[model samples]
Target: MPAILDDFPVLTPVTDEDLALAVQAVRVHAPEDWPHGTLCRSERVPYPCRLARWGGVTLAAAGLTDDQVSALVGTDA
Candidate 1:
């Protein structure tokens, strides 16, 4: 299992288009308050839904810090 983990979620080299798409995803999928719990604003799923997570990963791959990504998307989620 540990060995398999080493190769999981392969990350390709970040590209300008990838970074732009990631930022857009994060912006569109920002979290929203809910009675049950925080949820994804666009998809209405749990906070930090798959698209948000993907955006974060892509941003990180593009050498962006958490703060930078948050600022780029104008949200902390």
Candidate 2:
């Protein structure tokens, strides 16, 4: 018996192309007032726009360094 259970893997391998597609989906589905709109007005960032957030999580889960995700998302520092 272990002190902590591994449970299940929530993160899976993802490719750069996948991330790109997610980003595109976000952009395509973003509302006119997105990025600044209230959550009430929109239900969880709408359809594809939610992909951006999902992409970030997936990128991180795929073992990508923060810098890598940022670079892919054009937020490199």
Best by lDDT: 1
lDDT of 1 by residue, 1-77 (tens): 77753422416798888889899988999889999999999999888887788888888988999889978988664
Alpha-carbon RMSD of each model:
4.5, 8.4
Clash count list over all predictions? 0, 0
Across 1-77, the per-residue lDDT of candidate 2 in tens digits comes to 55343332234456667666655543443434457553322345444334445655665666777777556545535
Q: Candidate 1: what lDDT?
A: 0.83
> Which residue ranges in model 1 land beyond 4 Å of their true spot?
1-10
TM-score of each: 0.80, 0.41
lDDT of each: 0.83, 0.51
